[model samples]
Target: MVLVPLLRGCVQLLTLPIHVLAFLGVWDPLCKTTFPYFMSRFARLYNQKLHKEKQQLFSNLADFAGASEPLSLLEIGAGSGANFQFYPPGCRITCTDPNPNFEQYLLKSEAESKHLHFEDFLVASGENLHQVADSSVDVVVATLVLCSVSNVQAVLKEVLRVLRPGGAFYFLEHVAGDRSSWIYFWQQIYDPTWKYIGDGCSLVKETWKDLEHAKFSKLNLQHINAPFNWTPTRPHIIGYAVK
Candidate 1:
């Protein structure tokens, strides 16, 4: 009981500088510029660690587009195009991210992922994908995104709106751990600071619950621990939902 408050206070003290930068209105632009660079480097290791799980999650992607048509994929929060390698051959991918700084890194990833076809890189948020037409995509992918979205339900709704009938939505997201665990307790203590430092990511988002109620015709989701040293990001959910 006593340790919880002490830990929370320590987290707040550690993040005081970030809060000050945010108050001065320097944080957003600074984060937009620096985060993409950091993610470009970090994503390589992250992709390697989760390679097997990502392979299994994406194995069925080619089936979604059928034998004749090329797969059309829209990836929300597609930072640095980390998942590009996992996508099946001949996939026409449209990537969206709120931070335009990622375009350079995404282009580099696209160049490397020759098996996949590169489309447009849209500067948009998952909640409002107005640039993308309704029911136009064969697949919508969101990895480690739901945690940061201002409205998870709205993002899910937009996902449903943009996916064609029988189209699939694949997701792999870090989520809150069991309430009784010490990790969950620490997640609560660290979340506020984590959000600012992690570019609005929440350590305690029970995203599975929102997915459950999102009206997907077929939801095949499961919980698993990701191969991350960071405890808050270890608890994850991976699977796909079909419209």
Candidate 2:
């Protein structure tokens, strides 16, 4: 038994670099292609249950923010552009992501949300959203993006800086839990491997603190204790607030 565990540790150690490269897209023979496709495919199914809940949350946010019509929306980490269909009336949504696979979904969203016709799509990353003007957006959405950003602090700062006064910052992300010993263990074991597989996804960060430190005006938070499929330790936290 000791030898078996030791051998497994050794295997993981040896494959660490390979896993990192694959997760970071450095070792892709297809040049960083197909990985996003695979990830989007995975998200399409995994996120289906959460979508309805998210729409409700967004509706709540719309009411809380009093966004009637022609609201400006900037969404970072626009994975698969699934949220496009949820944009409220007269909303000008600017969905952004570095992944080209999301463009088709964005177009589909544009077609679906006809009332949200004033929409734009950008191929970009959260680290540098230079295309968007500072302090110009009325609403900022960072749903599930903090878990994967290269610099969570920078992204939060950007979100804070861009959002106008009374504008809301909506997010629904998986966060580290207080009582997940099994999740903690799996996180320790597969944390390094997932970094390579999920484009720098981290199961360790306490994102709640990051949001708190952003210094928003009206703070609202809700922690969901749902177990994840990949691991039981990491619980998904879904909620939002204003700035």
Candidate 3:
């Protein structure tokens, strides 16, 4: 018992430097730099697995824009521009992300997506999109973003503010499972560590509740298990809400 306590103390002492660096914000930039690389690989696998669902979800976007007119799309948390391929043709996309490191990846993805036009890349967070104008975008998109936002309600409000009168907001997010399910229990257990490792992503956010209360003029949302190996992210909600 004494040996175990001594080893625990020694481990804490060994990790003191790392804690100090984290406190001084040295680790943040490093994490930001490395995260995009891993995320890009994961995005490829995730897109492949959820191709059908994404196709169905994105098919509805054609209704928002005419054949001749290009749609003005604002994507919040547009990491690596992973959804660019699914967007309607001739879309003018404005990408915003909290991580500036993703800009390079976004540019690469934009080059590969010939059907879409890249407008601007803003370094911003979903909770506060001060750079974007009010009612300026025809569509606002958020995928796998609400889980990491500090305030989901604030992000939703920002999404609504940027969208035009008859605009739409599309979201695909992993949410907490039912209260009585084992998945929910695992989510609760993994949430604390997941936040740090997953870069502030919460494993247990009931994002559907926030969307329902967001006051969208017409809300159409549904839940399904995403075709991914990660159990925490399996319980997903995907759909669009009209403003």
Candidate 4:
């Protein structure tokens, strides 16, 4: 008797398993390739308006010592240089990122925000930025960085140390959800797994509390809930503080 052969197949569970796979570096290539493309697209859409609203903050990022010198700005975790477009014209920038995967993206964004001048790109982490001198920069920007860092206090102190007496530290971050809400509980529960998969982002960080204690000369902060962003990380803060 002859037997017929049957086709074989297995079902793949896409959602739940991706978390573990991403934890294993399986998603590194996709993250590196896709991040810049999405960042550029989003920057172009919101940068102009964001700059317009935050123009005063950007304008304050200047030195009057001599008109010949452009304002110097240092950004920690400058992923893809996405915030460059929001800076004032001719402001000189030095970008640093822990992930060198974004080197090419930074170069691309360097051209898009042509008004600002890029001085260099350093491979560095936010927790330690010793290469930048104390009170040396007119401004320091950190967007969407603190939650993933090893030490938020250390990073904030570094920002304060690098900024000139009157210089400003501008930041935009998605902090933890309200403590009273169930979202906060979920955030806490998912933190370990999320951090492992989402590049060390602590979705439950009460980052504003830290900023308040950081002792900025003057801090002006506002909390916002951004629509369409992931719920656990939707509690946002955008502000500037003088060092």
Best by lDDT: 1
Better of 1 and 2 by TM-score: 1
Tens digit of per-residue lDDT, candidate 4, span 1-243: 021111101112224565656768776666656665665566565555455445554555554212346788898988877677567788888999888877887888898887988888888898889889888888889888898898999999999898878778888887888887766766666665566455678988888888999969888898877553445766778888887
1 versus 2: better lDDT goes to: 1
Clashes of each: 0, 3, 0, 0
The Cα local distance difference test for each model comes to 0.91, 0.70, 0.86, 0.74
Instruction: Please give the RMSD of candidate 4 to the true structure.
Output: 8.9
lDDT of residue 208 for candidate 4: 89
The 10 consecutive residues of candidate 4 with the worst lDDT sum are 1-10
lDDT of 2 by residue, 1-243 (tens): 374356547657878777666668676544346556775676666557677667777885455333444677888877776676566776677888877666775666567667775467788888788888877787888776788888878887888787777788888888776644566555655555565556667877788888888778877788776435656324776667677
- Which residue pairs does candidate 3 place in steric collision? none
Model 4 residue 203 CA deviation in Å: 0.8
Looking at model 1, the pairs that clash are none
Clashing pairs in 4: none
Per-residue lDDT of 76 in model 1: 99
Ranking by TM-score: 1, 3, 2, 4
lDDT of 1 by residue, 28-49 (tens): 7898899899988888888889
Greater-TM-score candidate between 3 and 4: 3
Off by over 4 Å in 4: 1-68
Off by over 4 Å in 1: 1-3, 66-68
Ranking by lDDT: 1, 3, 4, 2
Candidate 3 wrongly placed segments (more than 4 Å): 1-26, 66-68
Top candidate when judged by TM-score against the true structure: 1
* Model 2 whole-model lDDT (C-alpha atoms): 0.70
